[model samples]
Structures are given as C-alpha cells and as structure tokens.
Target: VSVCAEAFNPDDDDEEDTEPRVVYPKSDDQRARLQEACKDILLFKNLDQEQLYQILDAMFERKVEPTEHVIDQDDDGDNFYVIERGTYDIYVNKDGKPLLVGKYDNHGSFGELALMYNTPRAATIVATTEGALWGLDRGTFRRIIVKNNAKKRRTFETFIESVPLLKSLELSERMKIADVIGERSYQDNELIISQGDQADCFFIVESGEVKIMIKSKTQADQQEKTEVEIARCTKGQYFGELALVTNKPRAASAYAVGDVKCLVMDIQAFERLLGPCMDIMKRNIVNYEEQLVSLFGTSLDLENPGI
Candidate 1:
C-alpha cells in the first residue's frame, strides 16, 4: 500500500468512534495559527514552514474541557499532545504528596516519552481551562516524520552543525557522517535511551532536545532517579560515545522534551570508518584521556585490559 493510504488507514481491527466531530481544513489561516503555536513550543519553534505544515496535517484537533484529565499518571501512553490553546497543570506524586511539576500554556506539549518507550505516564496532566489540542498518535507521527527522507536530511544537517564532536570535522566528513547515520523521531516525553539498556548506537540531535535522568544509589536504604540537565543537546550535539567506546550499558536515560529528530550512527559503521585511521584514533583517544586526567584526576579505561 502507498504511504498516504497506509497513513489514512492504520489498524484493520480498530472500531470507529460514532460521536460527531468537527473537521478542520489544511487552510492558510489554520497553517498560520499552527506556525504561531509551534513558535511558542521550544522544539517546533525551529522547524521549517513545510515541516511544520506536514506535522500539523498529521495531527487531529481536540477540544478539552476545564479540569479534564488529558492523561492520568501511570496510564499507558499511546499518543502525544500539542496545545493549540489554553493551559495545563502537570503533576506527579512525590513522597506521598502531590507536587506541581510544571505548568504548560498554549503551544506546550507532552506525552511523547510514553509513546516512544511504551512506558506508563510519569505525571498526570490536567487541563487548567477549556482548550484546543492537536493530537498525534505514535503510528501517524512516526510515519510522517521518520519515513520522510527529505525532512530527515534537513534535520540531520541542522543537528550535525550543533554537535561539538563533529564541529572540528571537515564539511566532507560532516556530510559523510550524515549519510552514515539513521534517523529516529520521538514525541515529547518519550525515552530515547533507557538506563542499563545495551547501547547499540551513538546519537546526534537533528532537532528538538532531550533530558538525562540519572539513577544514583544515594544511601543503603535509598535509591532515586534524579533528573539532571547535563547538557541541552540541540541540533548537532552527540551522545552515547561512552557506551560505544567502552561497550557498557547506558549510564543514563534520555527523555525527549519535545518532538525530537535524531541521527543515530551504528557502532559497526563507526568502527569501520575509524579502522583505516587506527594510529590517528589511538592518538586522539590517548590525548582525550590525558586531558580528562589533567582536569578531573581520573582516566577512562579505553584499552582492553585482557589485550
């Protein structure tokens, strides 16, 4: 089946909702409003006009009432939401107390992580006032974003420019890196990388941003997952090098803060490219180790101990 057909007709066993609904067109006014709404959201703010339109087209319009629960904490997440109007209160149960984690206004979005990772919702999001929302389920969102090669290319180029590791690389090398990598798109609140999972590939942010969650064994009786803003990896910032280099499980979990596009480099491809420059690779690794030791008084174990 064609891509458009497949997008329009998703699941064969799904039952249609009999409730009457208002349909909005892909009109100039709607497009302009969507562009404005995207601007207020950090992730979508930087997307090109065409890309924004494509995303807007994929989403379904939703009108939520005040005090309505959009998503309850611990619920299975299947869709992501983008606020077109009004506000929401995001809360989480902490230490037996309900804590207000965040307040989201127009253009704000959430529920991406659950769709991406198949995890339960981390927080309960309730509409503070009557609102209009754009809902994009996982299937439609991925089909639109990830399968679009042209969009992926643009995202890759934008992301590569922002990565520190590739900043020193030549233009040719950057292009080559972009060519070698594969794209992955996530809805907001999705886990890009899970702590303790086997790391298979390194990632470069093409668009959007992710937050790192670190689990620390604080005391004999306490273990807590602390969310830290290690670095705001936006277009071009690369991560997962530590796992790729050491063959260790991911030390932290990275969650998408908004609609995200990333270029992932397979480990085998990375090693293959570096194979011809073994001597240069060794020198660079050694230099990096020396610099780390000088600054932090500790060195990374890059060499195989058995070898």
Candidate 2:
C-alpha cells in the first residue's frame, strides 16, 4: 500500500502538505478611494452615493503608464479623464517648441470640452508618472452631466447667478434664460472670449473671474492697438449682453483669472425667449430709463423706450 501511494504522488515532499490555501479577490479599496476623490469633479459633483457606486463599478482598476500621452493637441477630444494618482503636464506648441502650460496632480481632470461640443484638443497632456485614471467617453460623460435629471437646469441656474448682466433679471426670466443656456468650465488663463471674433453667444460668470481687453486705434499713424481693461468680471457679473441683442463682433477678449465656470446662451435662443416678450422688454426699458433719469434727469432722450 505504501509503495502504491508513493507511486501516485508526483512529488513526495510537495504532496505532504494537505491544507487548503485561502485566495482573496483583489481589494476594491482603490476603487472606493477613486470614487470618493472624484465626487467634487464637475461631472460627478451632483451624483448621489448610490449613483456614484454604480459609476465606480463601471470604472475599476483602470491604469495608465508613465509618459503616456493622455491627449494631443489638435486631436478630436472624445474622452474625459480624472487622475486618481500621479501627475500630468499640459503643453502647447509655441515657436516649434512644446511649451509647458500647467501641471495636474491627484484629483485633477481634463477633457471636459468634449462633453459640450466637438472641439479640437486645446493642449497636449502627458502623464508625468505612472497613474491610475478614470475615463468617461464623450457620450457617457454628457449623459451624466447634461442629460441627467434636472442637472443641466440646476447647473445653468448656478451659472446665471454668477453673471452681472443677468442680475437685473427676475426669477421667472432667469428660469426662461436657463432653459436655453449652456454651461462651460475652463482652466486658468483659458480664453473665454476672443477679441474681433463674431459673438454668437453671451456669457454669465458662474465661478472665478475674468479680465477684459478691448481693441482700439491709436493716434500714432492710425495703428490699431488693444485698450487696457475697462472692466473685470467676477462671480455674479455678466458680459456680452450687447452681443445677444445684436450680432456684432466681440468688443473685448475675456481670459480666465483662475478656473472659471460660465453659462452661455446663443443669440438665437435669447431672441426667441426674452426678445419677443413685450412685458420683459418694457420692464428692462423702464429700469434703464430710471437709471438714466437718476443720472441725467429729463435731459436724457426718454422717447426711445428700447434703450
């Protein structure tokens, strides 16, 4: 019997141990950390715990390598990524050299513009170290941020509160404006409005600040130059109101002071909702008239009601 048992054992010493070994599935702690960290990100902020868990389940254990290019300038931006670990550098081509624009570390994010419109990548981003990143494609990201229940409306309202131009609007009018507005967020120094460009939309600041620069003609040989800032916009301030009323070129350029969030409404939408309402028009006219009367009294041209 001993001889037969020995013959059955391929390796005698190895077979001597009969205890079973415990095996554990990979820990979900990393995923939990990521979900918790991303809670404040633009697309994930409004999601509840249960909704966040669902998102975590769909996005676990994803990883990226050091020096990997997360995005390239001019590429079609179709994905948004959140860094769970490590760092990344944003670069732009200047004079045939890659100029470093900024660095993003843990909890940093990029690629949001893809969710709003199909715009080209504004800068190239490369992972500076081995990192874990969570990715949401354009379609999925939009479904969460723009298509989810009441999220878009709430975000638009939040944005409207930041612009000064919209400050005079009543709640009912604000809601009407919110229905047609779009929200956007940009990093520090990003250009929100370019001078001389045809203005298609008006913007309301939601968070952060912006600097305005105007183009002017100098007396020195009639040379055109940019004028110093005539206005600085902060939260609850609005710009480009004139653009919504008239399809004219932008009078000034607006650049992000830090990170900025804005609510933008196209001229067509503005005209459709707020322009035709005689009551609203009359109310605005009266408000403006009252201000003028306070400043200039009866000498002001009060006959033109639309001003």
Candidate 3:
C-alpha cells in the first residue's frame, strides 16, 4: 500500500458509540497541561509553540471507563493519544500469548509511532480506570504535521538535484528517494562522521558547513593525535556515499564547522530506493575514489585519498 496518513473515516452508522467526541483544550493553563502531558514524547518535544497549537486545535477529548480497550494490537492506527488522567495497561503478543509489557500513567502517550510511520498498532492499550484522553485524529495529524514534513522533504529533494553523485537521478527517481530521507542537526564543533568507522548512513549538507579531516600521526612536539583538515563542505555537498556503495570504512572524518543540518538516509534506504546507482559506483570504484580524492584531498595528501 502507498505510504500516507492512516485512513480516518469513522463509521457513523453504528448504533453504540464506537468512538468518542473530540474535545479541544482551551486556555493557556489547559494547553500547558497538554504540553506537559507530552513532555516524554521525543517526537513532539522539538515542536515549537505554533506547531503545538496546530495539533492541539485539531485534537478532541476522549472519556473512557475502566477495562475499556483504548487500542488493540494490529488495528489500523486511527489516532494518537495523550493521557490527561488515570492509567493504562499495554499488551503485546509474545509466543501466541498476550503479555503485559508496559503501562502508561498520567501524562503518558501511546500510538505515536503508528501515526508517524503509518504502521499498525504494535501493542494493545486498555484503560485501567475511568479517565480522560486528549487525541489527535489521523487526518488532522497528517494535515498539520505530516504534510508540513512532506513539504520540507520536497524542498530538500530540489536541493538534492544539484548534488554531484545524485544529480544524474531522474526527477521521478529522486522523488522516490525524497520519501525516505530523514534530517538531522548538529551543534558547532560536533562530530558528523568519524574516519575508520563503518559507515551506515550517507549525508548531504543542507545548511552550514562541515570540515573534513583525517587522523594523523601524533604531532612530534605534542602527545595528542590531532586530526588534520583536508576539505570543507557546504550546502548541496554530499559524503559517505562511497561507504554506502562499498560497505567500507569512512576514509575521513567530518566535524561541524558551525551549526549544521543535513539530509540523511540509512544504507537500507539507499539500497532499496537508489540501489541501481550503487552498482555503478562499485563497478568504477577506482575512478570514483580517485575523483573524490581530487575533490577532497585526504590529510592534505592528494595521493593518499585514503579510500
């Protein structure tokens, strides 16, 4: 099935209330409660106030009685919930038996991963007491958050079109890749990738710059082994594709020159969506490595590109 937000059409013809009415939290005190309830959710933690408001505006309150199944394993995830009151029991099937694996008390959240990835519920969550919940429906979450992410991704794809190695991809092919690529940020002086490490993710700098370096022999006058810079990368530049295609160690390290943001895709994503290009690079590995060395000298030694 195509990747998108979960289907959110609730059946209205059923006699009994299968779904509860949504009540939005108003007033700063209440929204503050909603914000506090979401403190532990890493996905929502980075969201700014405006973004948080969007989600809150689209949410509704759900009242549940004791022993009610708030979510069932393998069910299509319809909503993401935050506990405003009471507790819940989380269960997952193990060896054909339902096992209680976790619990969510006041201010706990469940069903976020499903909404983020459009996957089926992995665990069942049952209300353990008469309580209330704040929920964002699938459609609303997609409209407010997922759609914004999609827009950002398209912008990144446009930027990727100018990359040296990826420039050859057809617009449609690149668009496929845009769907799976993820973003990351780094603080100034932070390490982006280390030399001699097994590389699993390829990256393209989206903003700011990173310095390329290689570990060198300890300085004669100093006891420490300092990395020497060989190249500097800026927006629209990419690295680590060599390791993705060859499954080899990184030949050089990268450290953020300042605050940096990058578009990243893991090896699996590269292979699945952009696999054909992998072989092309592998077949001409020698020439490609040489070209890179020419582009970014290794340890200030052009001959020792270190690939």
- Tell me the TM-score of each prediction against the true structure: 0.40, 0.43, 0.48
Better of 1 and 2 by TM-score: 2
Worst 10 residues of 3 by lDDT: 9-18
lDDT of each: 0.61, 0.60, 0.69
Which regions of candidate 2 deviate over 4 angstroms? Answer: 1-27, 149-162, 165-307
* Prediction RMSDs, each to the true structure: 16.2, 19.4, 10.6
Pitting candidate 1 against candidate 3, the one with the higher lDDT is 3
**What is the Cα-based TM-score of model 3?**
0.48
Q: lDDT of model 2 at residue 243?
A: 40
Candidate 2 has which clashing residue pairs, if any?
162-236, 163-236, 163-237, 163-238, 164-236, 164-237, 164-238
User: Ten-residue segment with the worst summed lDDT in candidate 1?
Assistant: 298-307
- Candidate 2 per-residue lDDT, tens place, 1-307, comes to 2211222222232334342322222357865676666855545655668655545555534577888998998777667777788888879888888999667766556775534444577678898888888766554444444344244556567666554555667876675565446568989989888766766666767788988654433354237453545457787666765444434566567889999988666554454445544354345445544754564453132222221
Which parts of model 1 are misplaced by more than 4 Å? 1-28, 40-51, 146-307
Estimate, for each residue in 1-307, the C-alpha lDDT of model 3 and write its tens digit: 5444435322222324333434465877777777677655434533568777667776777899999999999888889887899888889889989998656666556675566567788788999999888888976665545545555555667677877667777876676566557678999999888777876777889899988876654355125656667667799877677666655677778899889998887554565457656655665556645655574453343223333
Write candidate 1's Cα lDDT for 158-210 as tens digits.
66766666666676556555544666799999988877787666777778887
